[model samples]
Target: MIYYETLSINDAGTTNNYITIRGAIDIGHNGKVIIDGQNTRSNCIVIEQGCGSLVRDWIYVKNLYLRRAAAEAFYIHCNVNNVVIDSLDIRENGLEGIKIIGNDDYYLTENGICAENIEIKNCTIISKSNNLYHEDNCVYVQMAAGLNIHHNYIHQRNKQIGVPPGQHEHVDPLQTHVIRDVKIWNNVFIIDSSVLGHGMILGIQSRPGRRDTVIIYNNYIYAGGHLNPGGNPYINGFVLRWYGYVNSVYPPTYVINNTVVTSNGGENTILQEYAGKFYNNIICQLGTNGQNPANYGGTPLETFASSWNMDKTYVDSVRSNLMWRQWTNDMSFGGNRWVGSGGSPTGIINGGWNVWTNSNWGGTGINADPLFVNNVRERYGYVIASNSPARNAGEDLQAFIESKGLPWADIEGKPRNNTPDIGAFEYENQIPVEFTSFSATYYSDKVTLEWMTATEINNHGFKIQRKLGDSEWKEIGFVEGRGTITEQTEYSYIDDIISIQTSVLAYRLMQIDLDGSFEYSDVVEVEILPAKFDLSQNYPNPFNPSTTIRFSLPKETRLKINIYNMLGELIETIAEGTYEAGYHKVTFDALSLPSGVYIYRFESDSFVQVKKMILLR
Candidate 1:
């Protein structure tokens, strides 16, 4: 029951793990099970499954508000093939918010291999670790076959309050080891001051013949830049190093369309020893590095990211990146060439970076202020302005990532224009209304549309549209939107269908601004269940002279009601009519019948149903 009540899963995935349930959760491997704390605190919640006994279920954990755990918030070591952990608020966990590890029995055949299609998504985790020299992580997965870590906001508040003076902790938002297929996207990694917090630490050794695919994209990493001009050590970004367990040729890691910015430009903002696929990224480094931390302003530190070995591949070709800062460099058309600031390349044209690396690699990169909607100097202000240089200045990523039907939308689920924008956000410059959610549901032969807006500016109202099957959309009704408000406002509209012609209906909303500027929301669809053809028991069964019986029909048909006696003889013909596909009622008057048990038979098309009633007068 909690499994079906927890998740609203509709699609039948390729894995066929989604099973529709209306009963208690007994089919373990078929549906989702939620261990919701109802927003209560917990010491910890452990979902551990040994290799000797694997459930291989579709496990999902969500809606939990866990904080201040003794160790980690959730110690999940499930052998389930796919595990989705989302929408949990984990705070001040001792070490990690979620920790996934396996035992030494990796190749156990008790159930099957522990190959995980794990997804740690849509969760907010914060750790205020006061460890002096210990390392901490928001998510640490050791042995997942394919991991999708996306849409999470992780903040490591390494405040260093309880620690001794002149000592700091180490923190990482995401750290994965030995993950074969790893995808980290659409996450905000906020690192607190006084600690060396890296955005992602992806460690995986090279496979002999098969490639270990790793993709990192569409993330906004705020490496610490408290701007104290006194404290806050350097904040690190992408540490893509594999441990030397099986050293071979490095697999191509695709780092594309990410916005990596630092408040305090510390050491190794983006560091990778080997060559990888880098394309259409925006690296903004504020202030300078260690020793001399003078240039705290938004000046271009061309030496911020260090990727010594860079190349152009299917995922990295046609690189057109943007760097938001003032830089002095010579422009030359070269692919993935890293050079120093205020200089030209002294090496080969196609040779990767020369150790120190560069900022002017000449792949459609403009070294100027990437005017964000808010001030770029702000720690995490990332969305570019309408007049920003980052707008429509990068590569077309929709075709690149969606050719294989991958999830390739911006951070806000906006579609990419032909010429996409740089950074994590695709610049649409949508003013007025920012909708949080909009949905439609069918009830009582009517479609009720509901929506909520996070913030509204110069908003007018919403024009509701409806359609059936492949028909054109028609304006159904309108709900007035909040004029201009910062608080979240919810709106709903009920469309009473006069006729139920189709079993499915689609609805959309056109949110018009006060100044005639308008934007359309995503279309929502609902399937209307057919009305059952049945007769309800008569109300006031033991009546003085009259009783009422209601019947529902699935389709238009002729119906008749007859009164019968206990001997099965017809006493009276009460009603007869051709009724439509809806509910109908009829009154049976037993004024002339004797005070005894009477039977009523309802005959429609070829079916007859009988019900006994008492007439006492």
Candidate 2:
């Protein structure tokens, strides 16, 4: 809860109850700090004690600058829990922008605690300058578990900056960590493997345990602007350094839904583990034109293969699929795509992105160009656009074979929209720019309204509209749109005036495109419960489309409800307005909605709920 607001205040100082920070400090003891460096020097704050044991307790450092430190600019060694550091401009440090390092031993000493539940996000961690002392990575995490790393732009350019070439010469590249059961998603890593460095520039590693697992999905990792050495330009595609054997009887590792692009680097293997299940992945080598004697190829499958125990049962499980008649121990393949060619019966049968055993491996399913939206921009932003074929193309093979429904898929095993494409891309109906996802939030004054779009191709913006009972809808606010943007966009509008009249209000977003095209998200209901909102199940089960919707009014509210068809269509309006108090309901039979499956939403002063019903023919 204390702030150290001096550029020179060191962690090796006389402060134990205060958090020593540099630049504008806006952090709270209630558990959040917003450090404003005014976008000046990189060294916003340095935290490394002369002694290893003298680390702080319960601190969250964020939104600052730091440099000339032995480790990351925002460094921590204490065994703190429920801590998060985010939204900063960090660069050019002795180490990474943020470094959270601790071991089981460090935790046990601090009240028998362990480093658990930590998150780092929305920060720019870059290695723009290559100092021999600045050991790799924009961020580094060690021995920490229960972590969520997302929404950060990390780039490692060692050659651009002058760094000598040696074994331990260049920085480790990008964010490097060793942890278990971690989720790394929605981040971008543009690694320039010029100075013969490691390719795992940004990743979370699991120290092999019987139950160890790392779920890496929706990430873009590509190598460019680097020198590709013959042996190992990018080096090991992904390094899962197993220190000891996993003796527990748990399942193998899980690698899914990632798009990895490489150049002259070494071989690219999704599952480089002693044991693991590799599925629903896309690994490509955006090969360079230059041919070196060491030039393996534009995409020389895997130049250097990491050693894995062939005797392990992992290989046996892969071959058991029946499709691989003679699948071998080393499942290494050369340059190829996942989808097979359009051959006859025995060609590309199995529904998975197919890699090849050699450059000549053929199949009718392989796409010369999987058709990515922006290859260059995507090279840095690791997430595929919503329109990308890789979005939901992933086959729920594991889920199906296990006789289980894929909860994470779009719905009902429908591949994104219709038939799925190969690789990670899933080309759903182009998510229009004017299109938005229904959203409702409770605020101090009034319930807030909002929506999100994956991409806005020609979005002119949005208009906030409200309706009461069966009354006609009217525009309340005009939101400026992006006109034309390629990235996912978010917009919000609030109704403070409605709060004084009633506890609930009905609202919707009227998305308007620049060209005058438009679309609407299903109406979402916002209920203002207590601090925590309880979403209630819809009422009048099996009733026609005109069922009465009801919910408890925890507080004063603005509410809204929009009905949609099985085809994701908006058909009816149950209600939208500021309710006085208590429980209430609105009716709307499918006098207008078609006879099929439809979803109706209820948004209160603070909460939102969605329910589905069948309009039995």
Candidate 3:
């Protein structure tokens, strides 16, 4: 590991400027790797490998603050592979924050090598200027495969100084060319055209040999350039510009589960060419407020039409229009909510196009308000309220992906329930009881269930239910609630009649309110053992002074049991000698010890096991 602290390099006069690295290396910083150009020209850092080097892979660059680069901040060139740039703060760069260029010779060769497996994650890039000599961007990648750009906050903050309004055009924050197998997800982009002098542009340039598998999902983008005086509005959010190559097959682009808000300017919020599928997206235009005018942007009713046999004339007209980017009938849009304010009820103007009222294949199209928790000017909170129509309005994307045998999850890391919410956020209404922890343990052929709640309101009690294998759930017993309370409470129940026929059992707590309303807690599963050595969790864990420890033995054997503190110091010998062939229990008294976690060990001639127990006084 090479660490740097406030290191400044000045290479304005040298042609091979900046710090160049080769081979597999890990470069990090304790404070910051400050590379100040002092307004002079130079690249910050460069990583390159020779054409046929055998020892080049896995270069990690992290925890650095790069600023004021005359050219690009970090330049990754030539045949370097497996590059990871993470946790970087790159700001006020001249040309680009990071530029990745593949060797031209490699692309021309029959089986030449290209840069592969590049990942840029958890970074903040703020570019205020577009280089006068070069087309500037925050991050530019050309000729790469398996690129993942996720969880980064990128914004272009206003035009460069001395450039007049409209003269300073903004570049894309993230632009790529000829890259394949790409996934851009879970990023927040807040772009102001006044400050950045350009709208949010997510441009992808596809070429031959590209896998055509690109996914842009779960992003929150606010693109508006109305703040720039005498400047055209930069309202576009995402655009896919194909290189127009006639391949026998084209890879499909998937645009799904994104929340995009465009307030002013620009032609369209989302525009795609060639083959694409748009699903479960929330596209909002601030000007129209959920109403679209009749025939807006010459949008005929057939534009919203969907069927196996599309209108040939309408498709031909769309293909002929250059403004539509040669869009043919090869695109499919569904499960999307287009909300704007204007026009009639069935249609709305969205980025120079008409939003159809008809649902997509997933039956998802709404023009009503999402009823966000706090959605105000410049402070857009996309969280849906309890009463918002977006709740339970989402198509089951998990099911859809499962049908295709693909793995997927929601933006918030929550597994998609049977019915998902419409927008990026899944609304989770608060339950009457707030459970902190729940667990189940088996001992002596009985299952002991325990749970703790941090708070409760108007609670009647809980119905204990159990299920065996694929059988029906049966109500086992009930535990009385404390009615209404804010303090943490603990409860436990035991089911002695666990069916001996089943090897697995599942338990859940159904909390009932005073009004008879109820909600079920997540199920906990337990496995029934078959005459093997096993140790069960201590009952009433975090006990004041004493607790019971249970264990089972398949055959008679001499055993020794001892308790030890967290520091591995023997505290007590609860049971030094055991004379049992079946289930046995021992009482551990910790009246003299302080509150902390302790470990218990049971050892015999052929078997040994250790378990942890908490003691709280």
Estimated TM-score for each candidate: 0.57, 0.51, 0.52
**TM-score of predicted model 3?**
0.52
lDDT of 2 by residue, 382-448 (tens): 3234444344444555443223212233211224433333343333444455444667786765777
Considering lDDT, which of the candidate structures 2 and 3 is the better prediction for this target?
3
Report the lDDT of model 1 for residue 544.
81
TM-score order of candidates, best first? 1, 3, 2
Q: What Cα-based lDDT does every candidate model obtain?
A: 0.64, 0.49, 0.60
Local error of candidate 1 at 403, Å?
Answer: 3.4
Candidate 3 lDDT over residue span 1-617, tens digit each: 32222232221112233233322334442344566655465666766554455434566667677778777888877656777788788888777888888655323222356677888988998876342423577788876766888878787554443445545555666777656667887666655543232233433434455554777766666665343343334435565545443341345666666666554323255544443555666655443222221212212111222222221111211210111111221212321232222312322223332222222111225555555444422323445566766666656667655543333555544456766776555655447699999999988779999999999855679999999778899998999887546778999999995335345689999998654668999999986654687777888797878999887777767888899988899988877665656566789988888899999999988789998999887
- lDDT winner, 1 or 3: 1
In order of lDDT, best first, we have: 1, 3, 2
- Highest TM-score scorer: 1
Best lDDT among the predictions, by candidate number: 1
